[model samples]
Target: MTGRFGRCRRIAAALLTAVACQSAPPARAATPPDTTARASGVVTWAASADRMGEGTAGQGYRLVVHTSTGGSDLRVRFTNAFGDRPLTLDGVHAGLRARGAALRPGSNRPLTFGGARTVTVPAGAVAWSDPLPGRVPAGIDLVISLHTPDAAGPATGHWMAMQTSYTAQGEHTAEESDANWTRTTGSWWYVDSVTVRPARPASGAVVALGDSLTDGWQSTTDLNRRWPDYLARRLTASGGAVRGVANAGVSGNRILADGAGQAALRRLDRDVLSQPGVRTVFLFEGVNDLKAHSGVTAADLVTGYREIARRAHAAGKCVVAATVGPFKGWPEWDPAGEAVRQEVNRFLRGSPDFDAVTDFDHVLRSPYDPERLLPFFDGGDHIHPNDKGMQAMADAVGLDSLDCAR
Candidate 1:
């Protein structure tokens, strides 16, 4: 009996040892966080800057602008490009617009430069604000309130905003109410561009380099009805990879000469290429150059186009050309200018210098009279198109072509 009990105990011990000797399954390595969609940054909204007028010290500007693409980490760029002296901006805030000169409750936030609320931009230079936390939705009116403590000399701003902004005598940038902002202005001060970090790293922006037609001069004021605005809406709705749109148009701007503003060629670097994540440069100017009878032949205009294309290509950006629309009834229109326009259109249609071509002339011309704007689309100027015509032009753009590789 004793021998049998000892043998049973040994067998039990052997079974326990066998179970402990077996190896356990290895634990799975923790899954790493996905960062493929994280974006570096992209320009969501922008306007071309020009010399507005003399700057007023202690004056606050509540500039309202429409955003094209939505994202987080908002940033603003202030320009002193045309200033002859250093521009000191003490207070700046950005918020969602509730109404005229009023911001939505809890939306107004102070903007900083290098972690400070104040920044001094040197003469003929620009400054970019540090990124602000929070997300901004697309197609919304963004109100930027800023105060210049020592803004003297020439003020660098966009002259024709179409949208009305407000002004106050003191530093009213922190206030969300419109009571302090009693004065109205038709220009955007200092601030030129706004950028956001999109969810997709592949997201990019397109800058429309043109004249008044692209600037929404004839479209209804306060409404974002420009062709570039329409294009932005279309891009958002279509869920395209290229979603941002920056309008770099100036009223009466020319391609070859400096008149109303710096020529398109001269301002290309500051107005278009300098914007973050710019994938394409959409060239649509030339009408003003030909209509002015500045001895700018089709060949000369084509050379300007080629130079723009070459510079854009050097910057690793795609170039898209648009044919000039018809304007037979315009006072500037003449047989000589019409001939130049036709020749330029032909070259734009067949040019290999551009990655893509948009035939704006074909889209805007009247079927009854090919040399004139469609009466339904004309804004009564025989040159600029109304809102409907602007939408049509935006609709005519091929979404796929905008994503061309450089």
Candidate 2:
């Protein structure tokens, strides 16, 4: 049921063996013209910019998502979309919530840089760790925690893949919050994406994109209860088409210009368009632009919607657009935001350019109001859907829309 790696050998031995193999293997000559950069080395996932623990709050913090079992040969990704000077890190460790919701060394490591713990990940770059004895599994969730004891501030927050992250007293709270992270330390700027060479290709991946509702903010951590995670399980069990899905939804992503990190339009070239063998794009995103930017007109949003449709069609990729769900009673939400959402939904329901479509609005709407999120499925944040609501959204997508299924 599990795979294991041979025990760890010091770096010197590894270098000595490589030096000897240089003769036996006959060095793979550099600059070979026939070389191809395959997808194998490229690990793809999504991230968002959120409010990390910052301010006079003394407890400034940020928790990026990472795989629980990707082995010690792995690298950690800390992010900072906006920060001054080269960000720094004190220490880094791989841990898990060992019951009581406490952090434990699920895989305690000698996390180092150039063979040391302290390193500065220059602004806008990702760092990788030297190979160690750690090998990871697919379903495992890891707590890639970053801690800082210095009063120096590099405050930039983002949406973490896990549901929630707890903090202790000082920088050590995150480290000591868990019975195991007693001596924890690490910090940096942008931990955007982590990469690990998977032993084999993933069964399959579905890229789910949308607003906060699709991101699953209030749900429990590492549970993968987001409908996309649930759908991954359902697909594997059915042994059917579209083997698994990767949630590409960012908390406040928009369809047009950059509202949070990159607008859906700019991100599409990366998120939907460039995804590897992405079977289908469960397209949904647009509410934040209408809600957050009061100046954006309904007509402008529709124009952006049509542009998405046109580009996806050109990619020869299958498309499934979900009607924007409800957000009426949100604390700062305005009535104008509601009307813009309706106009965009009307365009999506038309299903003109998309290869397939689903009515996410219809799936979560209360027949009584039709425009508001159904009471039972609302996670109280009129903007995002509850866990159950996420399930409903996934179910409405239906297996029939996927080409691999047919």
Candidate 3:
């Protein structure tokens, strides 16, 4: 969240009163057949079009399907974060392609819904495709195609998805007979997750909430190492005991006001409230407020965090707050801002709002400067953490709180 740009930033400091959030009714107990063994969850990678800017190329924007030689549902999520006008979608489809560089539409498959031809996405809106009614057996490639009205920005994503989604394309199950998959990179516009659930009793989910740092800009393509990914690896090591992590970081997201990515308050609905089976949240945002925004103070950051906590508590979910790590020597660091960072860290460490507390700042900071990042952990930019540093973050947290329904 480098405060280098000029935009309204649209930080939804005020909550959206449109949707009444009463509460998620308690999940019903599992039946005799569906045991805790069948539980599942999803890890969602989130980002806004404006947040990525023109930084990333779309070459990496791809949706890959991996099934166990059986048929499964293909679900997708589309975003209109940068859409200044109505996003007119002519076609949305999925297909299979070969492994060569000339990644033309490997094969052809059409993704359709209720047999409709198009979907118009409103500005700043997200649309999910109904689960494909088909099944994809294992050992195959399913590629989702998105034809947008304009070019994507900041970065593109090419990764294995966790949830089921629908693009403008129709049912992306094993049946993409009329669709096509191609080799492309960069310019990925938005992100989503997908999964298949049969007669499962429960699912587990991780909430990774933060700014551009949490979004993982330059780390690597499709190699999910954005801190939360590391935590996912840890969970996987637990052997299906933990479900998955859902990422809620927006690029350029700040704690106080809206500017870069939708500010923390504005996106709580789309990122947090609307997530499926979310049980825990990891918070490592706010350095941007201390460094980028000029009028921000400790009180403002605390107030914003308190609101986040209240929302999480009301949802019966656990909130893990990480101290704002050191960023004193960043290309954009301000000395006064450093003071505010320290002050805010003090409050987060002792605050009762968070159900749990993690010391990311203390673990990733340099001993020499204390206010700068550890040399090895720096992702060149003093703002974000490197892969190894991200792994350290996972190790430092008390992940036991996410025990699956045993």
Candidate 4:
């Protein structure tokens, strides 16, 4: 079933005009607000956005993302950063995913934009929905359905979700049953960040900025087994100050180059810095830069890391740097790449530029062969970690390191 679904695709339109019209201001008037100027609250769940592909008309998307810290006054944000034309959402609904396309009975609810049921997001912009007065619990599946009557051009979204989402034709936003949703997709479309007013002002969020590993590749599909997912669970269990976790990882992404998605530095402001209640920028990247053999030297990678820390600090956020892990058995592994990894790891461990450091290299590398991942921890590919290793990496992190006052 998974394999067949993987081959399937859903051509969908961007969010546009629909029922209960809530007309937005002219495209020029609508823009992504400065979240920093507003009151702070944790972003309970978020996925970075990218240009996925083209959109289809009359297409509906039901994206499911897992939440970490839960609170009331839940809100969602829709993005059109990669769209060439204004994208409009006609129907938008939120609910708990009971299973497949089904929502928990009575859990489904309609969401409006600025007191209206419709919103038109300008090209390369985003809009946040007005808060819904409901209690959204933690560690539950939040399903968001979107209907786009006139979506076209470049469709902006996260491509490697790792979790399965449902799709259908027309407006299935208000439905609680799975009957209308017939197609399945692994990408999260349009919607990016989901925030909630925290129970306490001290509770903030940590956004993990990395590549496929942080994006949960090799982890079980539909299961929250990403290292960030593990970290989120740990933070919640500890009842710490940084309880919210948002993953800003993109598969095949690099720290300095653009290919699979925008480079980490390029998308930093949109994916991490602008997020509400973000207190820490968890920096765990560079593996791709080294492996790609793109003339990126250890010095070059170090410069990238420093720039990330500098920008994050300017945003009043703490930076936690993670040592690059070993990937000896992977095809990209070579003496030059290994040396580069070592140098970068050394800088991460000793850099005062970072607020804190987590030696993920020491956590995931094999003691006997420091150049390779521990056999049990290797997710068969030698580059990505297994579920157990993900847990170990999370366990190795110092919860206190993330609770920085910024």
Candidate 5:
């Protein structure tokens, strides 16, 4: 009787132990999951292309571009958008400019397309290089080298680069010294966009989409004196989230017609919408369209402005319109064009369609003429602004207006 009683007690204890084991919670993971990954990219530099020029069969181009924001995973885009045939690049490289055509030792790194050494871009297409590992800083010249073994037809490139770049014969893309890169050119070829992954995830960029004035036509070359450049400096110094500035201006580019390049309306997707992390579109065009005397009316220009605003807003971006600056002294200026300009400026100033407006007309117009550029700011053509005018235009921008989400 004593043994049986002991067995029963053991069984009851075993049942309770099993119940406790089954009800216990599972152990938590030792490592916590990453919750702070950011996907936004900032465009450190850019130039807009209008047409394709002559293409050299066995040549290399050493392009120099200044960056506006610092970040890691540098990337570059080469475009053949205006070409009529396939353009093949055998090799491409990127590096920090130690000086004029010379690169910082150990900084010249080869860039690949999908891990391949060569890439051929089809007509009307663009290619992006795989992200390069390392950090690229702000306000420094970044040099890119490209070797085109076979290129022809319409060569897409940006005319009036302002900054000087190097060129040479054969495959000299691997060279760091300026030895083989003797020839110089003021135009940027194939390459159009440079982007970087910002340190902060939510950081964004602003694109200045306009014409010659925005293109820094007469501003001191290689000094980065464009209004957008000034704006970039301000954003960086202020430690704001919107630090990237892309200059998407073509000299003589218009808003309604496809003259200098494609019109602002036609190239909107490629130039503005497709850019990575663009938060605002600063529309400062129309002077060219109005002054061209192309039979464009004030109503037509206004309609174009509204279309731009609508497209940008649809893409979840802010649209900031700028009133057309005075151009009374320009050779193309006439009473009809001036009237149209005044009407367009008035609409921009009061339009609710735009998220915000900057009165460029007020800032650039002379107090005396009211329809002519300020003498102190004019670049002598009486149309485009000089360095001082560019600075003033940039200063007129309210930084707060640029830091907005849709």
Candidate 6:
């Protein structure tokens, strides 16, 4: 009887242990943290890079740019995309612009790559600088000073900056005064884009992919009066989520052919999709294609637009398209080209591929002559808009439409 009681007690204890084990929750599997939630910097200003003239050895460039969104930890990108040999930049500096070729006192700061003072970018490649420990204010003129010690190949830069930048004979990157920088050039060399870390992690940017009109071809020099510039001002004043603006416009660029710069299709990834913190792509091109008379029909242009929209969508970006503006008085204007423009604009307005559409044609066209640009807004060449016209184009854009879900 004692042995039987012992056995029964043992069985009851085993059953209770099993019941307790079953009642307890299973061990939770460890979840990995989401790194994508972290904020990288957003591009505050950008210019598309192309093949400039041959690079000069021991040359220093004081490139001035206008910022659209202000933020901390400012960074800059240098392009060697058109270079045939490795480009070595020995000195690089960033500062606020006090005047022509002059930096604000005590604002000049040094930049590095991998914690080193010098960076070597291979041919057909680009390099980004380490973040500087300061804030860059919105709509401010920022100057980037760089010196290439052994640069002797095809130089990569923006040809029609429409802003005055300075060049010197030797390494004067550390200077804040205009004593060393005496020569002025209407271009930006080496440096392409500037980025900053905004306080809000949700802040995003839009890239204006266009041609000469978008490149500020005829706008007042050093005034930052491009249509995108006007748009940036509006965005800042409105206090909207999309505060950054990158102008990826290359003058004389075409949609299907490589001419002034790589065709819009070829350079789309580098100029638009690859930009950091970009939520939208504002496409305002195709004039060159129509004007060139390369047998490019409206259907062909539409196909190109579809491809661009498709690629941008795949990259999780919203696409906003604009109708081609009037250019009847321009030298390249013809009835056939005008017809093609009309058809393309119609397709852009009704296309479901685009998240939004801005009718720039309606905004710039003359009421008296539908095919011609408005005289008051024409920049004299009839293809590009003056300062007032640029502002009108920006005003025509619905700010709310820029903040679209991708």
Score each candidate by Cα lDDT.
0.87, 0.55, 0.56, 0.85, 0.84, 0.86
Question: What alpha-carbon RMSD in Å does predicted model 1 have with respect to the real structure?
Answer: 16.9
**Candidates' RMSD to native:** 16.9, 7.9, 13.4, 7.0, 17.1, 18.1
- TM-scores for every predicted model: 0.90, 0.67, 0.70, 0.91, 0.89, 0.90
The TM-score of candidate 5 is 0.89
Q: Return whichever of 3 and 6 wins on lDDT.
A: 6
On TM-score, the leading prediction is 4
lDDT tens digits, residues 1-406, model 2?
1222222222223423433433222111222221112122223344443334442233323343433113223444444435444455544554443433354432333344555555554443334544333454344444555455442444544444554454443444235245443332232223444444444443334567766666767555556667676665566556544553556677677777676657887767644554444567777877778785467777887788778767766766567778877777876577777777888788778856677778888988888987688988887876667778877777777776755332
The TM-score that candidate 3 achieves is: 0.70
Q: Candidate 1 has which clashing residue pairs, if any?
A: none
Q: How do the candidates rank by lDDT, highest first?
A: 1, 6, 4, 5, 3, 2
lDDT of 6 by residue, 8-103 (tens): 445334433433443322222111122112226889999998999899999999999999998888888888999999888866888877779887
Backbone collision tally, model 4: 8
Which residue pairs does candidate 4 place in steric collision? 12-56, 13-56, 14-151, 15-88, 15-89, 16-88, 16-89, 22-117
lDDT of 1 by residue, 196-219 (tens): 999887899999999999998899
Residues forming the 10-long window of minimal summed lDDT in candidate 1: 28-37
Better of 1 and 3 by TM-score: 1
lDDT comparing candidate 2 with the true structure: 0.55
Per-residue alpha-carbon lDDT of candidate 5 for residues 1-406, written as tens digits (9 for 90 to 100): 9995564445334433433443322222211122112223788888886676778899899999999888888888888889889778766888877678987655666776665667777788788876776677777789999998878788988988889999999989878899999999999999888999999888888999999999999899988899999989888898888889999998889999998989999988888877888989999999888875679999999999999999999999999999999988788999989999998988898999988899999999999999999999999988889999999999999988997756
Which ranges of candidate 3 are over 4 A from the true structure? 1-72, 81-91, 94-110, 115-117, 133-142, 149-184, 190-195, 198-200, 403-406
- Residues 323-376, candidate 3, lDDT per residue (tens digit)? 988876677787888889999999999998887788888998999889888989
Residue 393 lDDT (model 4): 88
